[model samples]
Target chain A: METKKIKLPLTKEDVLGLNVGDMVLITGQLVTGRDRVHKFLFNERPRKEEIPFNLDGAIIYHCGPIIRKSDEGWRLIASGPTTSMRVEMYEHWVIGEYGIRGIMGKGGMGKHTLGALKKNGCAYLHTISGAAVYLAERVRKVIDGWKIDDFGIAEAMWLFNVEDFPAIVTMDAHGKSLHDDIEKTSYRELLRLIGL
Target chain B: MLKLRDGIIELYRKVATSLPPDVEDALKSAYIIEENGSNAKQALSTVLENILLARETSRPICQDTGVPVFYVKVPIGLSQVELKDTIIESTRIATEKIPLRGNAVDIITDKNTGDNTGKGFPVIYFEETHDSTLTIDLMLKGSGCENTGQIYKLPVEELGAERNLEGVRRCVLDAIHKAQGRGCPPYTLGVGIGASKDQVTRLAKDQLIRKLTDTNGAPVLADLEKRLLNEINQLGIGPLGFGGKTTAIGVKVGVNHRHPASYFVDISVCCWANRRGRLIW
Candidate 1:
């Protein structure tokens, strides 16, 4: 497992070098969003100028974190990646419209998103799905939030500064997907089991 | 009654943070079987480490704390309605105190209730029992694993499935194979054979509350459970579907008689977290 350290606002060259199964530790600013946030960006079609943060070369995390308000504004009590498949329908459009460089999530996405990664110069990073506290410790600070009232806390888009956040490149900019490979091999194994 | 409420709240905290003894033991054993430096081993190591960290920090073991489902056995004199209310209230308290993720959402509205309670949330099933004391079993069913659950009708020639044990075996294995890494392996599967669609599904979910080490009372079912567990691990789906040994840690099967025309099999796959707890009072 080759380990790579990537900074925010990644370039095409930065993501293109990554391959399926390579490990990565990302640093700098990352944005959080899940199903509703993706819908808001892709279907609602908000103007880039109206958006609170710059989308160019950004890393959008697929997560609906367990958070609470504290003296420090907001505290991420338990934060882990949600299943990425839920956002698959909107990912292609979002990647193109937002100039996204990477997506961090669990349960690697499907073919459409894999094609979008190749087309848009992006990669899909898979994090440990249930390791909430371990992932939360990597979050240094909550920078800002948007659409809390309409979308609720879980669905709201919150920005954060992270250091050494670990993930694996399951879908790379070269049109490769580890998830798809696993499904195919597993299905073959299943067929053999039933003597098909 | 007050003690029971407090006990339920404490139970929620314990279930959210710690893997039960039986589940932890199964996972540890599964980790031992995986080859060193394999992706499956790496995934299992992270899962074990996360369990320890969650206990130490008093945080939820998974970000998706899951919907709380409770099964209660009570004496005839106990008020089922009041007990249901207590469970609801305790769930609300647990949402803030143990800080469970707000999981209940209205399907039509796409609105999260913020608290874990809503119209049909914190599902509680009551059973009348001869015993005087009340017993409660709780399972935190995560969305990831729940999504992989499925029901299949038997006598389908396509899969060569009949209404017999062989058919049951096929459906169960198919479900596990399809789940792969999506449901978070190594998993514990709850299999319900021979009931109506709704009842069979409930029977499958209810089986999940049993301890991993417990065996089915029926001899035939016990044998089937053992066979399924062995065959599932052989699938090589391993932990997080990276492919290795130890796809499933355990399999529990619960059977009920069904209509002559139907042979339904319902399967509920639980991730390695296997968050469950019991309270007796």
Candidate 2:
């Protein structure tokens, strides 16, 4: 149970240092994106003015958070990770184009995303799925957002100042994946159980 | 006395904010038995803690509060139309007040309604019961787990699965196998077996409303449920599929009379959250 305290915007060295099953408590800025943002980032390849936040060395959280507007500002009600595989198709391109350094999500990505993570110096951090309220407490503030109107609240990219946000590096820059290992073992067990 | 709309809103809030007692109990037992410092143990610990925090803060347990599904039972002559209208209205109120995620999207336009309501949204099923009391069961099923659900027409040669219970068992194991770590297990599976695809799909989802502690009346189904539960947990696809002892905490099977020509099975894969509640008025 080696836990690393990580501060973003990460360097390539920071990503290379993590390994599968190593838990990390990350601080500093995290920008949330999901299906819509991935497609836009990959397809449009927007220049500086379109995207409000910096993607260079930035950690992207694969989330469609439940956010509400408050008198002071916006309140993140529940900030759980969405399934990571859905955005796997666009993630590789997003990572390469935007210089993304870290991916925080649940249910780790597929082979392409893993390969991109290895080639591009990134790590896939797996948070506890559906542990929304608990994880939301770690978000220090709602820094800013873009595409809230066009993409909708859930799909929009919002910058968050999070402190000690907990996650485990399931898919590391070394091309190791805990998900693949678990799936293979479980598939073997399934075959054994079904007598196939 | 609370109005029906108030009751429905409260039901939505309850399910969104907290899981039922049986689910929490199952999670607790699974947590107790897992190896300390294991990834599976740590994940379950976070889940348990999250559930408590949501309860304390009255916040949604998961951001994907899911597509709201309602199972409504009304007395004879009670207007289902009126009840559905109230349900739709209550859904809007719950979306804003409870602050549930606006999940319903326009299939054609690719736009979120931003209120969790749209054409055929907040799926509702109505049954006219013989009794006077009206009851509604609400489930906030997360999309991640729902996508893991599998529907199969039996007698498939690939797995050597036939139409009988033995075949059903094979199909179930395959479904769980394919699901792997994607849906955030330890899962509570609801299996529906019937003659038609639509019928079985509904039956499967209906079975999910059954409590983790409920006992199936049919001895054969109960035995199959017990065996399937044991077998799935044996797959070592523990909490978040990090690998440990518990892949699934409960397996529920609801069988219906099938036609001579067709045998269909649907598996409703529910994540550990398994958020659900009932309102009677």
Candidate 3:
């Protein structure tokens, strides 16, 4: 129930102090990425010169926003978190390779991701899954984007300036996961109901 | 016909932004039953607040606006081609006007059409009927729930599932168990039993268009729906799978005759948002 406001480029101490079920309101520079971005970063391994931004201690968001081109520039209409488990295959590689400190998305990741988070001193944040309009209000600005043509709107990487971007620490750096625990208890309950 | 096109856009807007009344009611009741100060309650409150914001702001209720699926019932003498073209045009217009997330992508080229319309986009299921009036039902189904949908060919030896209702019960519960938090519970399950493998899945999805508040016409199916709903909620997979009393708000089951050799059970899961609307022309 603790509400902590954390800045990006998080340190080991910053993530280690958080525990599963703790609520956080993150502020600072964040980059949005999803299925394609994960593949691009880990699988494709773009040339160093093609890398658009530095990833050292960066926070990666699992989001593919609904953005429109306005008279001035890109306008974010609804940007909610996408399911994170889709990127579980490449999360470990991306976290270790990029020196990422935090991952924000919905539904928790799998065992590999949890292990990677523990090893890399990173934490996984869970946002309300379909709160598109509510989450969009927290975005202060859209800084820039990269690989737009290559990945499409849902998969492109967009840098955003978000303030008080709320999420819950569902998987902490200590190797604990709220999702895994819930699944275990719920499964037991299911079996009990079915008399299995 | 132009009016129908405009009505389709409005329907899309309504489906994208406003949570349906039946769904909102279910959510409200679930919130009331959730323990005070529990994580499940907190999650449900967040979802309720999000729905309010979406309605006020006229923005998508979820980031993945999902593929626009239309179920159309046409009267005799109506041109199916004309109706489909109107739907496609309206979908593109809605993608820009309601500004729905450009969800339809070209799988081969890895490109987004950007307007939510592409080859075979805005999936339409047509039914020609004797009634003179035309009715269209639309549902915006997000991928999170879509991914959790399952189809199993019975008898599933592992689960001891057969072709009877007992087997269908086992499969439905298994699907709910597998979904856990991923499908964004509480879910509205649409179960289709006894159709061919390919058609069974479509039958399951078609069941999702039924109003959440409507009761099944068949007595046996209605009883099964009641039992499934009660058992699923008892799993404590509450709001967002955090653990509580309400995991699923509704379960709609549709059954059809099957071939002698094969029995298929298909489940279509829809998250709490349950964005759906209807139009009559």
TM-score of every model?
Answer: 0.97, 0.98, 0.98
Fnat per model, in the order shown = 0.50, 0.88, 0.67
Model 1 over residues A33-83: C-alpha lDDT tens digits? 998999888878998888898888999998888889888788888888888
lDDT of 2 by residue, A20-133 (tens): 989999999999999998888877889856687988899999999989888989998999898899998899888887889999888888999999999999999999899999
- Which residue pairs in candidate 3 have backbone atoms (N, alpha carbon, C) closer than 3 angstroms, thus clashing? none
A4, model 1: CA deviation in Å?
A: 1.0
Evaluate every candidate with DockQ and list the scores. 0.65, 0.87, 0.74
Model 3 Cα displacement at A182 (Å)? Answer: 1.3
The docking quality of candidate 2, as DockQ, is 0.87
Ten residues in sequence with the least summed lDDT for candidate 1 chain B = B234-243
Give the number of the best model, judged by DockQ: 2
Candidates 1 and 2 compared: the better one by lDDT is 2
Q: Which residue runs does candidate 3 get wrong by more than 4 Å? A: A47-49
- On DockQ, the stronger of 1 and 3 is 3
Residue lDDT tens for model 3, B67-91 = 8899999999999999999999998
- Determine the backbone clash count of candidate 1: 0
lDDT of each: 0.87, 0.92, 0.89
lDDT of 1 by residue, B81-181 (tens): 99998899899998999898898888889888989999889888999999998999999999888998889999767678788988888888888877867
Error of 1 at A168 (Å): 1.1
TM-score of 1: 0.97
- RMSD in angstroms between candidate 1 and the native structure over all alpha carbons: 1.3
